[model samples]
Target: MTAPEPTTDGTYRDRIIAVEPGGNEFIADADRHGRPSQLVWTWASPNLEFATIFLGVLAVAYYGMNFWQAAAGILLGAGLGVLAHGVLSARGPRHGVPQMVLGRLPFGFKGNAVPSTLMSITAGVGWFATNSVSGAFALSTLFGIGPLPALVVVVLIQTSLAFFGHNLVQAFERFAFPVLAVIFALASVAILGKSDLGAPAFEDGVGGLGGFLLTVGTTFGYVAGWAPYAADFSRYLPKTVSPVRTGFFAATGLFLACTTLAIVGAASVTIATDATDNPTDAFTSSLPEWLASATLLAIAIGAIAANAINVYSGAMAFVTTGIKLPAHIARALATVFFGVAGFLIAWWALADAAASYEAFLLLIAYWIGPWLGVVFADQYLRRGHRVEGFLYDRSYTNWPGLASFLIGLVVSVLLFCNQERFVGFVVRAVPELGDITFFVGFVLAAGCYLVFCRAKIEAERVAL
Candidate 1:
C-alpha cells in the first residue's frame, strides 16, 4: 500500500526505513523519540495502480459506447485520482506516517476511528469479495467450471499471497509487468488490425446533460479508494523530493496507465460480446496461441497483488484505530477476518455482481470521494505545509476535525447513498445525487473544525 524512508540519521531504532526511486532516503519515524528505523523503501515501481481499475475493455461493454466516450470518461476519473493522490501522498512523507495516522490530525484520536474502521472493513471485505468473484469468473471462462469452484480457488490464492505482505506483492508486480505489457500489446495490435475504429462518437446518443454527468459520476464513484493512500506511499520519501515530481511519478503514472487500460477494456467489450462479465476475458481473446493459460495466471496473480495491498492497508487502518494490538498482529487478524466475511458476501450477494458492478462502484464513490476530499483539503490547506507532533499529541484532541470528519461521513452515506439505495441486490447502488454530496462533506468537516477552534478561543478568553 505504501513505502517508508530508510533510516540513516542514526536516530531512533523504531523508524520505518524506505528508499525512493531516485535513491532518496526516508525514515518513517517522525517522532524519533525512542524507536529505531522501522522505515524502509522495501520495493519499487508500485505497478500502475489507482488508475488501472478503469482500463479494462470489458467495462466498455456496459455503455456500449465508442472508444472516444469511454476514453473521456476514464480520463475524467483518472484526473480526479491523480490530483487527489499527488497532493495527499506528498504530505504523508514529510509527516513520516501513514494516511490514517495523518487522518488522526483532522479526525482526532477517537474521531479517526470511524473512517479507519470503515476503510479497513471495505478494503478487507469488499476488495476480497470483488477480486474473488472476478478471478473465479475469469477461470470459469477457461475451465468451463461452475462459479463456486472458481471463487474458492481465487480465495485460496488471495489468502496465500496476503500472508507475505507488500514484499511478495511488489515482487510479483515487477515480475509480471512485462508479461502484462506483452499480452496487452499483442492484443492491441490484433484488435487494431481486425477493425478500424474510424471515428468515435463522443456525445452521440448521450442525448443530454443527464447522460454526461452519469458517465462522469460513475467513473468518480469507482476511483474513490485509490485516493486515500496518497500519504501511505508518500510518507517514505525524503522530505526534500519536490512535491511536483512525487505527484507526477506516482499519481500521473497511475492515472495514465489506468485510462489506457480502461480504453482497452472498453474496446474489448465493444468488439466482442463474448467478453465475460470479468475483464480477464479480454486478455484471453488476444493471448498468443502458444500461451493461452498464461493469461488466466496473470489475472489470478494480478488479483492477488492488488488484494495483498488492500489487505495490508486495511489492516493498518483498523489496527491504528483499535490502538491496542501491535501492527503485526493487527494486520494478521484483520486480514483473515475481512477475508472470510468478504468471501461470504461474495457467496451470497455477489452472485450477480458482474452484470451490475457499476452500481456497486458508484456506492463506493459515494463514500470514498467525500472522504478523500475532506482528508486532502485538511492536510494541504489547513496544515500549512508542515506536520508536527501536535497532530498526534493527546492534549490537542482536535475536536473540530473529529466532528467534521464524522458529519461528512454521515452526509455522504445517508444523503448521497441511502437517499436512493446504498447497496443494490447485486452491487452497491448510486441513484444520482449530484455533485453537491461530494463538496458537502469537505465543507462540513472544515466548517465544524473552524467553529470548534473559535469556540475554544472564546472559552479560554472568558475563563481568563
Candidate 2:
C-alpha cells in the first residue's frame, strides 16, 4: 500500500487524506468549520488500548509494587479513570478526531499546546525512561550484563522497534499479550499458596482510606494519558464496534488485572520471602523458569511488547509537539532517549524506597487532575456532548477549560509540595488526602470550568 505523503510540511499531518460532506458532522477542513474529517488511523486502531490498559496496571504491579498491592492500587487508582474513559473514547468514532484536536474545542488552539506537550513529556521522557529501565533490569538480571550495558541494550531495542512503527508493533503484541497472560497467571497461582490465610482484605497492613485512595489514584493516573488518546485507535474502527462494549471490556479488564497483579505481588512477598524490589526475579527464582533457559526469553518478549507501545505513543506525542520530522525518525529518537534514561534511573533505587515511590507516584498523579478534569468538564458542560467544529477557531476557545486547567495544575503542584499552608494542613490532618489527589484535581477542574461555562452561556443568551 502507498503510504500517504506529506503535503507541504515534513510531518504526516502535513496532508489530509479524506473528507465526507453532509454525512461528515465532524470538524475537519481548515477551509470549512465544524465538519468532521477522518484522521488516518495510520497506526492500527485505538483497539490497541487493550495493551495500554494491561501495561498500565502491570507497570505498578511488576516494577514498584507486589501482586497484592498491585490489586489494591489498580482498583483504587483506575476506577475514576475508567469512568472518564467512557466520555473520551465514545466520541472518537463519532467525529473521527484525535484527542488533542478534539481538545482544542475546550482548551483553545494555543491552550491545547499544554496537553500535547504534557503528554509528550509525561509519556515521552517519563514513560520511555520507565519502560527502558524495566527492560534493562530484566536483561541485567537474566544475563551477566551490568545495569549500564543492559541499559544500552534496552535503548538499542526500543530504537529499533520505533523504526518499524505500526505494523511490527501490532505483530509484537499478538505474541506478547498471550505469553504475558500465561506467565502472569502461572506466577499468580503459584504464589496463591502464600495467601492461603483467607479471603482478601483491603488492608495489607498498609491499610487506611488514605493509602487506598492514593494507590488507586496513582494507579489510574499513570495511564490517564490513555483518556486523551483512547479513541485514537477507535476512530479507525467503524462506529459499529459499539463504544460501550469497548469501553466496558477495556475498563473491566484493566481493573481486574491490576487487582490480580497486586494480590499476586503481596502474596509473593509472603511466599517467596522476597524483599527484592523488582518482582520479576521473585517469579523466576520461585518458578522452575529461573534455572531453565526460558527466563531471559520471557522477560525480553514482555519488555519488547510493552516498550514498543511506550515508544510508539511517545513518538506520536513528540511529533505532535512539532519535531518537524517523519514519524519513524521522531519515534526513533524518543525510544532511544527513554531507553537510556530508564536504564540509568534504575541505579537510583538499590533498596526498597517505598516512601520515595509513594512520593513519586503522588507527584505524577497531580498532572492527571487538571488534564482529566478539563477533558471531563469540556465534554460534559461546555459542549453538551456535541462535537465542536472549527476546533482551531479562536471563537471556539473555551476559556473555562483554560482557566480551570491552569488553576487545577497550579493547585495540584502546590498540594503535592505540602509546603503550601492550607494544603499542607489538609494533607497532615487527613492521612488519606494523598490517595485522593486525583479527586481534588478533577473536582476543582470540573467545578470551576462548569461554573464559568454556565456563566458564559447566560451571557450569550442575554446578548441575544
Candidate 3:
C-alpha cells in the first residue's frame, strides 16, 4: 500500500508510512480524515502500559493504603484527571496546532515559552526517564540483560518511533491497543483473583484520612500529567469532529485503562507474599511463565507507546519556544536531544526507582496543576473562539497569564505540598490536610487569571 503524498493544496491526512518528522505549522482540514473514536485508542494504548500499574503500587506500598481504598482513590483521581485531558484534546481539531503552540494564545507568543519549556522538560526528560526505567527493568527481567543494555534498547525504539512523528505514533497506538488490553486483562484476572481484597487498610499504622488524600493526589498527578500534551494527537482530526464525542472517547479510554490497571497493581500488592519491593517483578512473579513473559513484552511495548508521545510532544514544546529552525529538522533534533537527556535521567532513576517515581509524580502535579488552571481558564474565557493567527505571532505577550500562573504555583507549593523531599508549612501544621497542591494551584490560577485578565482578554478578542 503506497502512502498518500502531502497535498499540493496543503490539506492531507498524516502519512501512515512516510516519516512525518515535522513540527506543527499547517492546520489540518476536512481532507485529513479521522474519526473521534480513534482518539480513544490513541490515548488509551500507551497508558495501558506498566507505568500506570506502578501508580497503584505506590499507593499500596508507599502511601499505605489498602487494596479497596487505593482502588477508590485511583478511580476518583484518574476520572477527574482524564476529564481535563479530554477537554484539552477537543481543542486539537479546533486549532490544528500543537498543545504548547496553542498555549501561545493564553501566554502570548513570547510568554508561551515559560509553560512550553517546562512541559518540554517534564514530558521529554522527566516522563521519558520515568517510563524508560520501567521498560528497561522489564527488558532486564525478560532477558537477564543488565539494566543499561536494556535501557539502551528501550530508548532506541522509543526515540525512533517518536522521530518518525505523528502518523506513525497514532498507527502504533491503534495497533498496540488490542494486544495490550488482552494481556493486561488476563494479568488482572490472574492477580486480582488471588488478591486479599479485605486486607487491613492500616498495615503499618499508615492508614488515615491523610494517607487516603495523599493517594488521591498522587494518582491525580500521575494521570493529569498528560493534560498538556492532550491536543497533540487529536490535531490531525477534521475540525468538524464533535468536541463532545472527541472528549468523551479520550476521557473514557484514559479513565478506564488507568483505573483498571491501577486497581490491578493495588490488588497485586495484597497477594504477593514477597511484598511489592520491585513493582515490575512483583507484578509478573505471580503469573505463569508464559503469561509473565508476555506481560513483560507488553509492558516494554507499552512504554514505547507512551514515550513516543513524550518525545514527540517534547519536540513540539521545544519548537514552540520561539526557536527558529526548519520544522522537520528542529523536531527531529529535539527528539534526539531529549531522548539522550531522558536516558541519563533514567540511569539515575534506576538506582532508586520507587523514591524517584513518587517524587516525580508530586513534582509534576505542582507545576501542571497551575498550568492547567491557566490554560483552561483561558479557554473558557475565549468561549470557542479561534486564535490561529496568534499561534506564531511573536509580537504578542500576555503578562497577566504569566503573573497569574506564577502566583498560583507559589501559593500551592507553599501551602499544600506534602512530599517526603519537602513538606509545606501548612501541611506540617495540619497533617490531616494531605497534599492538595494540585487543587489549590488550579483554583488559584484560574481565579487569578479571571479576576485580573478577563477584561484585557475580552478586549484582545474584540480586536482580533
Candidate 4:
C-alpha cells in the first residue's frame, strides 16, 4: 500500500475524508499525517460527557465523600490513570497499528486473541451499554420519552460514526469539543456556585478512609478504561511526531476532562439530594429550564461521542482477534452487531443506573488492571523498539503474558476485590482495605511478566 501524498501544509485531507479500507493493517507513512495536538481534543471531547460527570457524583453520593475529598480523589486517581494512557498512546505513531494488534508482541499472535476478545466485549458491549443508558436517560428526561426508543436513537448515531471509522471519529470529536466544553463549563459554574465546599466529610454513614480508597479505585478505573484504546486514535499522527508531545497532549486531555467533570459531579451532590440514584435528573434539576434542557441535549451528544470510540475500538479488537473478512466489512458488521447488543444491555441497566454504573466501573478495573500490567511490562522490556515483524506473525505463542494476566486477574479478584456481588477473602476479613484489586493486579501481573517473560521477549526482539 502506497502512502497518500501530503498536502503543502503537511495535512493530508484524503486521510480524513476517505474511509479507511485496511483492517488492522499498519498505516502507510503517507497515510500517517496529523498534528499531535489533535489528540488533545480527540481524547478530551468524548470524556467531557455525562458518564465522567456521573463518576464524580458517584464519589460524593455513593461513597459519601465531601466535595473537597472527592476532588482530591479524582485529581490523584485520574492523574495516575491518564499518565499510563499517555504513555501507551505514544506507541501508536511508532507502530502504525491498532492498540490490540500490538499486544501480539507480548502475548504472541494467537495468544493476543485472549485480551483482544475481552477488550472487544468490554468496549463494544460493556462500556457502550453503560454510556448509552446515560444518554437514553438524558433523552427520556428532556423529551418525556421512554428510554428504549431513546437508546435506539443513541445506538444508531454512535454506530454510524464507528462504521465510517477513524477520520470521521476524529472529526466528530474535534467538532464536538468546543460546544461540549462551553456547555459543561456553564453547568460546572452553576454547580460550584451552589455547592457547600465545607460540608462535613462523612454524611449518612459514608466517608471513611475505606470509602476514600474506593472512590480512588473507581475514578482510576473510569479514566484508565481508555488505556487499551490509547493508540487507536494516535496511530494516524505522522511518524515523526514526538512521542513525548503526543503522550503529553493525550494525557492532558484525559486528565483535564475527567477531573473537571468529576469535580462538577461531586459538587453537584452537595446541593442536590439523592443525585446518585438518577444522575441526569439530579444534575439538571438545579439549573434553569433553558440551561437544563441544553445540558440534557449536550449529555446525549456526549454519550454519542464517547461511544463512537468504544464501538470503533471494539470493532478493531474484534478484527484483531483473527477475524477473516474485508476490514471495512468486518468493522461495519461489528458496529451493527455490538450496537444492538449494547442497546439491549442499556435498556436493562436503566432500571438501576447507580448500582449498575458502580459495578461496571469496578468490573472494568478488575480486568483492565491486569491487562495494563502485562502491556506496560512488555513495552518497558522492549524499550522503544518497533515490532513490525511481529504484527502478523501468528506462529509465535507467548504463554507467559497469558499466564501472568490470568494469574493477576484471578488472584486480585479472589483477595482484594470488594464489590456488591462477592467480597474478596481479604476484603471480607479486613473491611478497611477497600477495593485494591486494581493495584494488586497491576503489580502482580507486571512482576510476573517481568520475571518470566522479559528474557524471552528480548530474545525474540534480537532474532527479529
Error of 3 at 97 (Å): 0.7
RMSD of 2: 7.7
**What is candidate 4's lDDT per residue for 1-464, written digit by digit as tens?**
11322122323334565555656777776677788899999989889889999888888877888888889988988987998899999988887788998898778878889989999999999999999988998998999898888899999999989887889999999999999999989988988898888887646634677778888899999999999899999988888999999999999999999999999888887784553445697788988898899899999989999999999999889988987876447777877788888888888898888888888899999888999999989988988564676677767688989999999999999999998789999999889888889999999999999999978877876776
Order the candidate numbers by lDDT, best to worst. Answer: 4, 3, 1, 2
Segments of candidate 4 deviating more than 4 angstroms: 1-18, 273-277, 384-386
Q: Which has the better lDDT: candidate 1, or candidate 4?
A: 4
Error of 3 at 262 (Å): 0.4
lDDT of 2 by residue, 1-464 (tens): 01121211212221232211111113233322111121111122222222223332233332334345556566555666666655666676555545666676567666677777776566545555554555555677778677667767766665566545544554455455555666566655655654533334433334445445545665666546456555543443444556665565545544444445544544544443465655345445565654322544455555555556555555555554433554335545555565555445544642332433444455566766777777777566544433433443444456667888888777755554332233544676664554455667778887887877766644433443
Off by over 4 Å in 3: 1-12, 275-277
Best by lDDT: 4
**What would you estimate as the lDDT of candidate 1?**
0.54
Task: List TM-scores for all candidates, in order.
Answer: 0.75, 0.73, 0.95, 0.95
Give the TM-score (vs. native) of candidate 1.
0.75
Candidate with top TM-score is 3
Better of 2 and 3 by lDDT: 3
Query: Would you list the clashing residue pairs of candidate 4?
Result: none
Q: Candidate 4: how many backbone clashes?
A: 0
